[model samples]
Target: MQLASFSGFIKTLFYIIAFYYIFRFLAKLFLPLIVKKVVEKAGENMYQQQQRQQQSSWQKNQNDDTVIYNTDNVKKPRETKKVGDYVDYEEID
Candidate 1:
């Protein structure tokens, strides 16, 4: 029969703790670079969108002709015949 040993347990525990610390150290080293790249990409996208909006507005300005319409004769609303009485619902307490 195999039995558990204290030294073996200690070794395993030490390895796990070491691996955790190393992972955290590496993340602290590289997380900022990753975040900075993401922010720069977002800024570039916003700049591109602004440029497109400006170009479209400039194109619209190039065609500034105003067309006027005459609305002197207009049709009036149709008259409705007699209908059923309206019933409004009341909320019960």
Candidate 2:
């Protein structure tokens, strides 16, 4: 009877080890797929947000004429032309 119990205990231990290995293999197989799905979902959400922002900006521009800066009325300040702002330096070895 003691021998039978020992054999049964060994069998149960083997089964537990097998189960652990099986679960580890399954985790390895599915982890990448889970990460890939999460990344894809995040990318899709980012793209959607960008598209919404662009659409909203476009709509706002269409509703308002002064949404963009007017280059015609805003003249650039005149500056005096200067020659040779940078000095050429020579490195001696």
Candidate 3:
């Protein structure tokens, strides 16, 4: 019974080591691909954000260009005579 338990422990340890190595090997193989995909996605997102900003700015500029402020059509207020007591004071510094 002791021998059987010892064998089982050894088998478990071997499997653990084997699984660990397998995980490490697979990670090494696929880590770069995953990183590359993440980087590409980030780049695409940044590019899309820049495009949106540029499009918004361009639209704002186009809207600004279309605005027409005609001062000729605006009526000026009639000038009125000043009616008040004028007081002259000297400022002393």
Candidate 4:
């Protein structure tokens, strides 16, 4: 009876160790696949979000009526005459 119990205990311990190693091996094999799928999904979601934002901005610009003209090459108005008069004065002591 003691020998039977000892064998059973040893069997259970062996099973536990086998299961732990199997789980670790499977995790090493599948973890990278899972992480790669998740990263691809996140990238697709970000790309879709960016596309939506660009589309919305384009639509908003189309719906607006304001016409913005570029003024980089436009010259400012030049003054015709000087307004302030020059006054000559000497310091008195």
Candidate 5:
């Protein structure tokens, strides 16, 4: 029974060592591929952002050419009424 327990412990220890190396090996092998994919995704997002910026700038230029405005065409800010003219409060009992 003692020999059997010793053998069982040895087996468990061997399994632990094997699992540790297997996980480490898989991480070392696969992590670079995952990182490469993430970098590629980031590049794609950056390219899309640049394209959107170009599109917006082009649209702004087109709109600027179409609009004709002068001082008379622009509207002035409205005058705000005084608080005393708008609100009246009485004491409550």
Candidate 6:
């Protein structure tokens, strides 16, 4: 089996360091933009929810001023029973 070379080890280490720095640079460049977009989206959703609540409240306010008349209480009268009452007799032993 062949032994690992020192130059190969150095080259691998160099690649790892290079990639780490590149990743950090890209993250610094894009992280703020990503966070800002997320914040704006959350704000938009909150605004939409507030708008929906306002519309629902507006409809409720309109309904509060309206009046309804009920005729059901006057239409139905008390029902009278036509059957006679029965008396039960007990037998004495």
lDDT of 1 by residue, 1-93 (tens): 988899999999999999999999999999999999999999999999999999997778778776545676777788998788899999999
Clashes of each: 0, 0, 0, 0, 0, 0
Per-residue lDDT over 1-93 for candidate 2, one digit per residue giving the tens place of the 0 to 100 score: 345588898999999999999999999999999999999999999999999999998998899877466689887899988885798999999
Question: Model 6: per-residue lDDT, tens digit, 34-73?
Answer: 9999999999999999999999978887889876566777
lDDT of 3: 0.92
Clash pairs, candidate 6, are none
Using TM-score as the measure, name the better of candidate 4 and candidate 6. 4
lDDT, residue 31, candidate 2: 95
User: RMSD, model 6, all Cα superposed?
Assistant: 15.1
Against the reference, the lDDT scores of all candidates come to: 0.92, 0.92, 0.92, 0.94, 0.90, 0.94
Quote model 6's TM-score.
Answer: 0.59
How would you encode candidate 4's per-residue C-alpha lDDT over 17-84 as one tens digit per residue?
A: 99999999999999999999999999999999999999998898899998867898899997798889
Per residue, candidate 5 scores C-alpha lDDT tens digits across 15-85 of: 99999999999999999999999999999999999999999988887878575556796789999876665
Model 2 residue 35 CA deviation in Å: 1.3
Task: Return the TM-score for each candidate structure.
Answer: 0.56, 0.56, 0.64, 0.62, 0.55, 0.59
Q: Predict model 5's lDDT versus the native.
A: 0.90
Candidate 2, superposed: residue stretches over 4 Å from native: 1-8, 68-93
CA deviation > 4 Å runs, candidate 4: 1-4, 67-93
Clashing pairs in 3: none
lDDT for model 4 comes to 0.94
Provide the lowest-lDDT 10-residue window in model 2: 1-10
Tell me each candidate's RMSD, in Å, in order. Answer: 7.9, 8.1, 14.6, 14.5, 8.3, 15.1
Best by TM-score: 3
Residue 8, model 4: lDDT of: 92
